[model samples]
Target: MSAALLPPSLSSIFSSSSSASNPYPLHCVSPPFNLAASRPARSFLLGATASYSDPSDLSLVSPTSDLTVQALDQKLLTLLRQRKTEDAWIAYTNSPHLPSPTCLSRLVSQLSFQNTRSALTRAQSIVTRLRHERQLHRLDANCLGLLAAAATKAGHTSYATSIVKSMLRSGYLPHVKAWSAVVSGLASSGDDGPVEALRLFKAVTRRVRKFNDLQIVSNSRPDTVAFNAALNACANLGDSEKFLQVFDEMPQYGVEPDALTYNVMIKLCCKTDRKDLLVFVLERILELGIPLCMTTLHSLVSAYVGFGDLKTAEKLVQAMREQRTDLCKILRESGSEDLVENDESVFKKLLPNLTKQSDNEPPLLPKVYAPNSRLYTTLMKGYMQAGRVSDTVKMLEAMRRQDDRSSHPDHVSYTTVVSALVKAGAMDRARQILAEMTRIGVPPNLMTYNILFKGYCMQLQIDQARELLKEMVDDAGIQPDVVSYNILIDGCILVDDSAGALAFFNEMRAKGIAPTKISYTTLMKAFALSGQPKLAHRVFDEMLNDPRVKADRIAWNMLVEGYCRLGLVEEAKKIIEKMKENGLYPDVATYGSLANGIALARRPGEALLLWNEVKERCRVDKEGGKSDSSIAPPLKPDEGLLDTLADICVRAAFFKKALEIVACMEEHGIPPNKTKFTRIYVEMHSRMFTSKHASQARQDRRIERKRAAEAFKFWLGLPNSYYGSEWRLEPIDGYDSDSL
Candidate 1:
């Protein structure tokens, strides 16, 4: 453990990148914080194979009934943690008796991180059954964390809060980690009212103080951590003074600033890019003689990057390298072995954070070819984060010199670059990376090949993906993992090969990669998109047997959309109830997608009802906060997508319904733009004349044209948006003006 002592409060800064796989590790700022500060040589050895940490990590600290089981559990936890939840779940399902609840809990907790919605549900059901059966020897806090996390991830934020609340009532009150979790949950969810979260945190502290007053006033205060969390809450509030106070509390409360603390502060300072305070905090941290961590460096780099201040970030990036080297050097010399002793925080599984890769600035490595074979893998990961693949080759070439060949660049380097290339839709680059991996005698891991297969499958190159599957069997002889099979199933869906994909899914199940939600979602969307909503519902039923797939919102949303398209509003309503029963909450996208579905069904009145529901949702949910995305580009109530739905409605012989939808769209704020107005009058009339609807809707088109004339006049009078000349388009030769 650290001689400096554990602080009473340790704030966690969740620095999530955009990539699902590349989560920026929580930059925690707790005194005497070091990468290996408390992790033993055992954790490192296990990290190599296990690839992640399990909730039962603390369980492994004590003797288990089965030592072999314990070792495998450790390794499994590592894998789950490393954005490998599906792989872990597959292993758990295939294994006998399974790693204990705590072990499963860690994987469950990581569901959010892994985006394993299905796995989270299965694990939760297991936990529920275990509790009902009175199978617990002791309550595992880690499991509770996972439960709460899953609740939130499933979009039941209120239920997640309830889980945390119940945990406290069940005598787990001293753990502030849960409070921090709620903070993180709120932050990522873009939820409103963090002030309530802070109050709850305060209540927890008060309870702790009452229980142990002397400890509360100790030298190691957790103020730094808690204050940082408060500061994070401030970011949402945009409360500058409160934000500053949170920053000032780091030292005032005697809690030393660690990487996460700095990261939180850095983001807060950069929120407005107010340079005066930014310089002060930067100088203050340097003066404290505490080493600045990578998160803070990234934040600073990003902060300056925002103002087009690459020159400043570039200079600091160099300084950051110096700091990283110094810290690494200190760890290297600090007996390199003392890192094995520290910690008093309770173990807990966590909620997932959706992170994208964040390494796309200037190159961090030098052009010079001094290949530190040892850091080659690290450099590869860095390059991948920066979204570069060619650099991976450069590093590999450097490794070739001086016989520095260390077999392959290990999974980290390979997966990093490969994952990035795949996400950027650069299949060619991904293939090149895979080829280079094999060319250099570094046989690609099954995971690496999966990445390539997934990329190809996404681009609808099922033939190529299948060919690689054959290679895995013949040349590699490696069995496919669940993800490997999932990709193939998804590819089949894209090609409307439900029969084939179902066969593959069955094969996967036979091979023991038990189907997850994804297996069914593909089939559902495939059938639904193919105009077979009935088949979609049936697949959803079969998927529910897995427990995890039951009531999944993603599945529900697909079903709702499909049913809506078929004008099966009742079925769509049923799908929504299933979603809510599963504790999933719908977001704007979910609502927006469903609303469009209603319009397609010629249910303009129903669509308007759903639209009003959205307005209400937006009102109370000021929490989802405006996204950093371009401010929605001025959608008119009567414009954009309604036109498409109107077209569909008209095709379905719902002429009056199509006009109603158009009217609703106008009522919504997308009043018909010029093109839409023109289309409603001229385009619809043309299409009606061309199609068989002319007899019934021709008079309606005449009425629409009269309204369009007034709308055109209004649009022409508008300032910059007016385009009278553009609207003239030769007056649609021979168009009957008398219709108006």
Candidate 2:
């Protein structure tokens, strides 16, 4: 067909001008395959929709059928060469029979190269179709590996797993890149993804071993990259046992552990709380003569900083600064030796026992690495975490003064300083750092401005936050993302500006920025706190309608809080029931809000029921059947919730329940506000038994209430006395007797 007469989709395929810009150009010296000599060239377009015929069945292979199959195959190939993968997929699926394996493989390769969700889905479909047709063996190993990589890159790791399994079943040991991509993908994936990655690693090792035992010469054995990915998974999961098992197996495969391996092991140590083993990693690296990389150095410094041992972290950095090679010796001779002594057995079990070095052995650290911007930022983060704002500023200044260009601060380094100042409520200093970023040509990014927005919001400076957001757009030309709007919404909450919060939320949607779960919950919080429970409900409904955001436990709790804040106990209860229907049980915040609502509604019986549910989830001490700190429960209650419930019980004269709550608090290491309870007791129940009751049953109930009150007073270390008289309850000698 002529170019002007061709459809738009097919027109691009024949546009020879596009070949100049095509990144994946066809390097064929001739046409891909032979066409029939007598077939008329005019049949190319007309034969596209010709009657279907099975290419595998020779009886149906007429000249016209052959022409149609060849025409479709050639079209698919041309589309792939032009990088029109989507259109190529459409053409492939519309064909009556499978295209030639070469054309099919090219189509799969091109689609996989796109690495988009839709493209990967199509690639997976092709792989599945090939398997169904029993022609999977036709695809080359390189093409299969590309499909696996694409599936992994698109976050469909399970699909990648199936592709590898097919490759293995077909007697093709997958290439290293194929299985390694799957491993790395699962390792970085959250939740049980790391565990599955580790499992896949073991499966691959076993398969390789089986091949070896059968005398099948296979080069597809797990290599260093594969082992590192598995080890990283172990680190993420804090599975020290699996980490050691995998580390010990590396040598059997003739794979030497590299610096990245040791770095991952360092992460495992920090994650598993074996900070004492940090030095032993370095020791083992030295004994094995592994060349140290900058990442390993960064890991060592970060580990110490993570453990809050700033003195040791500083000493290590200072040693590197002075080019001293005695870091291990210095650490061993210093107070860290005591830490090692305390965890000696732990270190031995986690790592191989270090052999005593002979006198001829080289120094423990062969070379000292100077700190880079990343390493310096890590140490500065330690200062930030420790609340030493001045020291963090000093570290940034030190980075600027360093002569080594590698040590000069980057955007991350500057952001750390801003984060520190923001945390310390030093917004002015934070802005100064931002100005410096622009002055030095390291123009502030969205994250830098977001931090400023958060700082302003936290300080209830909404007008300032607004001005910053405007500057971030108009001056910096950076649009506000979901996080920026979420921060502003929360700022509106702080200033009790619910309408303002809604306006920002609407504006965010108007700009096509999807609100995350945080945005919805923050806006709900604004409405809840502003006493507009119905508006909060509307926001919650909108959040439910949003396909992108899922309603998590926090979102449900915010809805419940909205109703509970207005003393709408029944509505809150209904929401909680709905929350349970969604498979989310009430957490501490849910119960806390309910407790507040019950108090506001003066529903003491509801408080008692809520307490029953909470008590069941609270850990019980075996000693006195009280809640324990050592044993974690399914729902550990915070002090705010427990205190709120206890106050309700005290006000309603549920003295025995009040005593139980106070005991639970003490067992959990939370000191009860005895003075507050005592004050409530005096104010609400001062004349509890003064009135005489005509009915004997009523008098007996009064006696029980009086007895329980006296017991509660005794627990609070206050002397019980008749309240109708001038005498007042007095604190015992040991009690501080201060008001809460």
Candidate 3:
């Protein structure tokens, strides 16, 4: 891919080659090409990965006048295949010819297979440029399909979704393979991806059917791969109906379900506690003569073990061992005659006792012929589910004792145990496991430190979190990133250590570790809640000056609210206009602050108008209209804002408006409680009695008492006649109505 394939956000990678300030450890795998070992130097390789802004020297190609565009393209591809990545990239970039979309697609395909950070970055740039610029209209089905495939392989789900959605919105439906890649990426993410994937699948299918265009429908139809992705999505999200619907639709799509497909279905059935469906899927697997891989057998074992059916699980395990021995014997007998007699399968039951193979025993089978780690890990998982922590640890230890490195316990195994301990609130035990990991020659990395940091924060042990942060650097020798700092700051704020949070914030900046949006937001909120609004503004202004840190909607809202809390309504209003100019509309927090500020500034009418505008925007957003000024989803009327409105109404002597405000609160399910309403009523009369005409009222005692009585009756929402004689109103614990 040429430089034209670079995304705008990625263009920076080409300009700067320095990696000095990077907190993460650099681990580069040298390629066959004579490329520089520096991080940026290895970023993009021609025909594999390429970024273009400054044109390469075209003189080299112009000297060879006979080099046609086709010949140059072929030469570049050959160089790439020969692992001369840099040479190929230089030649391609220096060539004067505009490469075809097919050539760009081929380059993207190469980049996808490489699981390096550089390769992933290059793939994103290429996919973005392809979809947004440079003949997007001319993108054929094959090109679209390959783009999604590349994104999936690179784990760029957001980029993949953007490409597909952009195409769909422009009436160019994606091919089945493209749709499958997207669904698979989202399903595997384990976040809100499951919900989004299911929604996208339904919307696309419905839209395709509604259009009823034969070509478009056929090209964009969901296949077994797509269905499998959707099924996995449902399984992750516990959407049982959606799972079964996808399972039942396989044959309708004329696609045969494979063993992996059945594995996922059985897993889902096990997860959803549908023993009947589990049996049904297992029976179908057998009926179809689908050779069960270890995954299928493991799922079966795990389900049985999970439900306390260990008697049946033991039988199933014995049967699986027998089957494996038979298959191995068959392979030894049927293949190479050069095999030694000792090559025959030797079966043994190594249970409960964890030990390495004896010196007299035959050498273990190669990794390709050995059982995968998951087969045992599955049993460990079952023991975990049964709450047998000791048993699970023993199983994990047994795996570690094995001779083959491939069969040893890995990071996932250790992390799983640590995660389980953390969830059970056994932080000490989890920390012990982390130490054990290092003792076993598996040194703890950034992820290990992060898990510990999060555990400390969740427990509200800010001091402990701070100590861990130091240990991560001083002992573990791992550089803490922005996430590490953010966690510590958040933990401090949770413990009301505002000064400590600010110290950490300053430390982060001094270390040249740029604060992210989360970092700024954390500090902003901490100071705001700590009643240091001026300091919050200082933080916001600092964020604004830093080019690397972009202030998001949350940051802006915090700035506005902080100003309002300081009774700086005009300052808050000025910030709102700046927010709009930056294409960020004021959200609920901003409006809430504005309303409160208006009331505090003695402008009740304007406050009412601002509150109404907020409601109107909320209504527009809720109905799914394109609200021009809507930056976020609508929120309920803020509690502080509601109280302020009530105060404003009482002070202005607009009792009718005050009642309406209370009614609105009831409709919104956040009605002002009795205690708050009574306080407001009392405050209203206190203000009325302390008026400028108090001296004159004292001279005319009878008139003063009459007016006070009438006001008290009005406040109680009673008829005027109720104040006549039966219910005589008097100042409580006071000398006189005017003097008190």
lDDT of each: 0.53, 0.75, 0.61
**TM-score of model 3 vs. true structure:** 0.56
Instruction: Give the candidate order by descending lDDT.
Output: 2, 3, 1
Give the better candidate number (2 or 3) by lDDT. 2
- Model 1 whole-model lDDT (C-alpha atoms): 0.53
Scanning candidate 2 in windows of ten residues, the lowest lDDT window is 41-50
Query: Model 1: how far is 732 from its true place, Å?
Result: 29
Residue-level lDDT of model 3, residues 1-740, one tens digit each, is 12343234222322332232222111122221111223232232122223453232233234444557678778777777686655654564566754455555556555555545555445444443432233344344455556666666655465466556655665667788887788888888744678878877776676676764567588678877888788889888766667767767667557677777777766675566654344445545654666666676667667667666655555555544444433322322322242223322111110111122122222211223344466666666666666777877787788878776776887767776776676566899989999998888878777767778878888998778778778878988999877888988888888877777777776775574657778888988878777677668777876665433457888988888777776778888888999888987776677878777776678777766775666666566557765554444455665666667766766665554555566556666775755655566566654444455567657455454445435444545544544545433344445454321
Error of 3 at 93 (Å): 4.4
Can you write out model 1's per-residue Cα lDDT over 1-740, one digit (the tens) per residue?
12133122111101211111212111111111111213421111000012333322222233435776777787787786676767776666544445766666576566534435444445544443333333432335565666565555554444456556655555554244555566555554443536655555555555555555556434223455566666677766656666655555456446666656556655655564543233334434544455654444445455555545444544454444343433222212322232223321110000001010122221222212222333454545455556666776576555555344442456556666788788778988787877877786667888888888888888989999989899878887788977788888888878877666656765665453545567678767776776678767766665553322344567878777778677777788777767766666565445556666676566655654554454444434344544534332122232444555554544444444445555556666665444544454454443432354456566656544534443343342432222444443122435543311
Clashes per prediction?
34, 0, 3
lDDT of 2 by residue, 215-316 (tens): 452456788999999999999998887887888898888898888988998998888887766776877787778887888888888998998988888898
